[model samples]
Target: MREQQENAAVLRVRGLNVDYQTKKGAAKALKDIDFAIHAGERVGLVGESGCGKSTLLKTIMGVLPKNGDVTSGRIELDGVNLLEVDDETRRKARWAEVAMITQSALNALNPVRRVGDQIIEAVRAHRPIDKQEANALVHRLFEMVGVAPERARDYPHQFSGGMRQRAVIAMALALSPKMIVADEPTTALDVIVQDQIFARLRELQAENQFALILVTHDLALVAENCQRVMVMYAGTLVESGPTEEVIAAPKHPYTIGLINAVSVLGSDKQPISIPGSPPDLMEKIDGCRFAQRCPLATSICKDQMPEAVVIASPGGERMVRCHHWQQAEDFALRASNPDVWQSVSAV
Candidate 1:
């Protein structure tokens, strides 16, 4: 465990575990997850579907779905633990301090209300601002996210998918949050629109200097935008470190599998799939959560759970959980085919 004597982190999640009370049993969705994001840092949480990436975001926003529960852990924003706060305080702190931009902007938007009204409502609810000022801010925010200033008056149906996403982002900006939990902020968008949204997000973060947590299944996106990368699998963080370093040399087997799925554009190799599905969380985990899928997993891995280890690398500290991580073959060299990956310089 890393110590935080300075206590200046923008956000900190410690031993966070989420569970669902289903008929089968208490299905653990999140393991003992721990990570911290500093001001102006772009931290990407990358993993496959059903890996608890979105659930983690929902818990952070205090909007856990109907059956979700925080089994144990602490989520702190600016040194204040959100888990301990009362409902009123959580309500006040929710969008004000920690905001989240959900997956679908079109569906997320209110069908009947005008987009401008929605933005105004968000701002007014958080702070005691007058309607006139709120309206002005709404227009400014619309312009900020590259939306047409006049289009703010239109309903959600009037906007395109991209515009709807931008509007949602604009609404999330109403309070000027210190941190943003964006879960697939660019889902289902075409390449051009995705680039536009990401560019706007980067610009806003640069201007406001807020911590950003980008949760997505796309490893390529994470490699491009994030300063640091945290790879999650089966509800646990398997590896985390500088993005380039992790991309170049992943320490964990699951991370290697992720890299295998995407060949670096500059490299000359073919993309390879991991060849297996994620383990079912409903079942009891007797050993490493990834042992079932890890090609390098041995009998020991099948019987014992591995703890996170700070692997030594010239690039950076890549915290990996596989006991045999140091012995695994490097996946970096396999990404020789430009067909599977693109060069960062191209971006």
Candidate 2:
């Protein structure tokens, strides 16, 4: 039986499409991607750097550069179309409703300005608040994200990479937004510090009851922290489901390939890698985006796209797009050694 519909979605993205036009040619940066985020849900968008992960976020935040345009789609946050709102309305609706801690938020800060001033500025921009009240709120934010409240007076250059990131997060929270989209929040940091950031972000999300959309290339961490996972390739969503089920056993060939590359997921006893690169967005593709690299590719896969198939499990439901997901799963189950499987699947 199908699960009962939960009419509790906070954000719904339907048939979303984005494109870029240059003198050379037109590029489909985002295909007909569809997904929904419920209240307080933690969803991870996992994919390679060029897989249109970041581009999709930019479109949602209403900050797409002049080069990119929404060809067609609906980004409804709290029942309003974000794309339909004008600049003036988007400005007011932005931070107070939906804020983003974009990648490299440390660099997003002005080097000379006091970090406290930045938070205060953000708060005052959206509401009628004085600097004194803003500073108090800023101090609370700093403490919440693990930065020293006293250091709020310091400039961006004075803090370490992690500290600056915490400050950036503090700034993003000045409005107490309903949802936050964090793009590669821990990128370029050392592994130890990366762990700290991930832990801290998880804690913050828990306390706020805010929906979190985590976009990153880290497959292992996504499986650990996120409630659900969405895998994308060549501008389209390839797989999506609860983290545990997808990590334990993947259905889509691309999802399997992602798991195979991650040592923690049991795809490899040691470090294994998925071979070949993804197709370029600047060029047109007639069939599956991963057909060029998929080991299970057939004439049907090469010449046409596969519709999504639902895989049910104890943890959660998974939606995969592949003509031969079941076939690939059967082969891998029989072909891989038991001992090798043990190393990859510690859970």
Candidate 3:
């Protein structure tokens, strides 16, 4: 039954390429990105900073900055190509079909207006509901997110950080969107609040059955909340598969490095950092972007870009982009040694 639903994806992105125009040149922010999310499925996107995670989300929401352009790709939501739609059509689709929960709730809410009014306006903008109906919906949403309904009339300054975030969640749920893109939604909250918010979000998702795309750097959070994970490196999707399988046996060197860099509880192994920063996107490169930093990279990896190779897994098909994917077991063994990573110098 799950496989059948996976076959009919709720959202799909194919061959996406995005670039930002700068004085130096066009910086390739997203390169040939492809993925799909089924109805009610949860997928986590993990990557280091400046690896195009936010860029991908902004592109999907049609909210990219003025300089950022989607050079080529198709962002299909329920078989409708979002890139082909007009500005008004895209605006209508937002919150109604897809919504975003940004990292900064303070930036998302209006400082001067009441929180409840902001949410009501969001609902009435896309929906033809009256003020009374919208107000009722806001009250219900506040209750769902653990925010007090009576406090809806309070300004953003009056609410605590956690309360503000909950209010943002309430706004995102106003229209019960089909898909929600949460980009580090709990970045500013305490650990306890983060856990609570996630618990509430899980409950809401189970009830609403909306597809969720969680963009975060927290691999532990991903392992706990998401069923699948996608790893990005230097504007490219290097690996993606079932969360458990990918976490246990990563096929990409970059993915391996990321797992090793995190400190695990009850584990004595010291975290090994991946040496070297990511490649500069402004410059054109012929080979894999991770070659300079990857200990397993060879001459071929440095000379030619590898396409994504699909491998069968117990959970499903896993995709990895590496010329030496056949030697992943060997690479994993060698990657555990800190000397191997330290020996590589960025070219």
Query: 206-243 in candidate 2: lDDT tens per residue?
Result: 88878888998898778767999999999999899998
Error of model 3, residue 128, in angstroms: 2.1
**CA lDDT, every model vs. true structure:** 0.83, 0.81, 0.92
* lDDT ranking, best first: 3, 1, 2
| Pairs that collide, model 2 | 266-344
Worst 10 residues of 3 by lDDT: 1-10
- List TM-score per model, in order: 0.91, 0.91, 0.97
Any idea what lDDT model 2 has? 0.81
User: Each candidate: RMSD to true structure?
Assistant: 5.5, 4.8, 1.5
lDDT of 1 at 321: 86
Compose the digit string of candidate 3's lDDT tens values, residues 1-347: 55675567989999999999999989999998998998898999999999999999999999999999999999999989999999999999988899999999999999999999999888878868887887788889999999989999999999999999999999998888999999999989998999999999999999999999999999999998998999999999999999999999999999999998999889898899898899899989889999999877789888898999988889987999999888888888888889989998654
Is 1 or 3 the stronger prediction by TM-score?
A: 3
Model 1, span 1-347: residue lDDT tens: 13542365888899998998888888889989988888888999998889999899989989988899998999988878999989999998888888889888876788999999998888778778887887789889999999989998899999999999999999888899998889998977997999989988999999998889999888889877898999999899999999998877778877877877776688876677765677888888878888876656778888887888976656545688888877655534443334323321211
Model 1 regions lying over 4 Å from their true place = 1-6, 263-268, 312-316, 329-347
